[model samples]
Target: MGSEKKSRLPAIVATAVAVPVAVVAGVLVFNAIAPKAEPVHEDLSPVAVEVPALSEEDAVVCLALTATAPESAGGLQARPVEGGAGAAESVMAYGDPAVVATCGVEPVAVEDTALVYKLNGVCWYSDEAGLEWTSLDRQVPVGVSVPETHEQPVDVLNDLSTAIADKVPAAAEAPTGCA
Candidate 1:
């Protein structure tokens, strides 16, 4: 009986050691066969923008307006503007070939016969080619230029009008073509 117990001990010890070794080997083999996870890279290089001189009131208004700008627009993340704090405060950009927004831009002049869109209480005037849209009813006009690659530039205006409505006040008079 003692010999039988001694023989069983070796089998028990071998099982304890082999079980752990097998588990370790299985884990290593699975890791080797599994698909590797690759890190995702996002382009965040600074975008170039030229800042125009603004009136004191326009400057203040633009700073406030830009402060309320969203972190993403038109499915693109916001990129850094090149011209330091002044440009950052007055302008914002998104994606490559960036969609740029400049506060305190020249106000849009909409002819009575021209088309105008009123979105979220903000009036917008689009250029002929639909590349640029300007806020017509804000104290400080905000211009957004969308690249031609974007099929629906008007949607970009619709998205930004919310921020403009929140931060910028209505002009003294409503736009001529916008009801």
Candidate 2:
């Protein structure tokens, strides 16, 4: 009886060790055979981003972007606020092409912004509907022409943003004519 009990103990030990080793080997084999997942990159298109509701007389894009890039608590006064602090302060200040993406608003399309090449650090004058020379610090060529009504919405915005980003570098190359 003692020898039989000892033999059973070894069997139990062997079973326990073999089960764990089999499980581990099976996991390794499965991992080797499974297809790897490709890294996912989010499509950062502005229109792709869900747009917040828009009410007339409200600068939704600017306000949204301001929220994302908030300044220090009291620095709120220093950081530009959209529609409230004014367009020039809000839009002209952002020189990055990523502004539209950050704001989650499609860039506005207008007739006059087409012909005129807007310089970097200048606003498109859209928040105020072109009524007041509301220029904001935005990315775009200093004199890059803003898009007209006929141009595609996404294309125009993308172009304008790209222009804004390009304008700064171009301006740097051109000698200062004013001063």
Candidate 3:
């Protein structure tokens, strides 16, 4: 019984050592035989970003832009003229004869004292309007589609630059983090 127990101890010891070694060898063999994962590649190609042209109807000028006037004879104030037609309430008037005369422009009289004038692509009238050259203008209507206002003329150009930036598509792709 003693010899049998001693032989069993050797067998158990051998099994413990061999089992760990076999496991390690099996792991090495598996790593060498198993297929490796493929590397991922990104397909980055240039794409054309097309943005359509914006029209006046697509954008609207703020009421402040159409009404505010810098210092001048014809355009001396930021005053809004409310309620004449549809969406006409945003218009403001700036009238200064002294500034107008200095700008080197003539006035076309609408009334005896009030003259209809065109300046800076805007139409307006000054009661005591005098001939002057200014960066601002008082432009009256040559025909239909014109309204008379007593303030300095202002024409707000509706630009869609901001809208274009938000609406335009990305024509190119940028790299992400170290994927």
- Compute each candidate's TM-score over C-alphas: 0.73, 0.31, 0.26
State candidate 2's TM-score: 0.31
Per-residue lDDT of 11-95 in model 2, one digit per residue for the tens? 9999999999999999999999999999964333222122333343234444433434422211111222234233432242222
| lDDT for position 120 in model 1 | 76
- lDDT by residue (1-179, candidate 3, tens digit) is 98999989988999999999999999999999999999853222221222222234321322222223232222233222333232221222233211111111232334333334333333334333322212112121111111243232333111111211222222232112101
Runs in model 1 lying further than 4 Å from the true structure: 1-42
Report, for all candidates in order, the number of backbone clashes.
0, 27, 25
* Candidate 1 weakest ten by summed lDDT: 150-159
Order of quality (lDDT): 1, 2, 3
Best prediction by TM-score: 1
Give candidate 3's TM-score. 0.26
Our tally of clashes for model 2 stands at 27
The residue-by-residue lDDT of candidate 1 on 19-72, one tens digit each, is 999999999999999999998666779988989689888888888977878888
Computed on alpha carbons, the lDDT of every model, listed in order, comes to 0.84, 0.35, 0.30
* Model 1 CA lDDT for position 40: 63
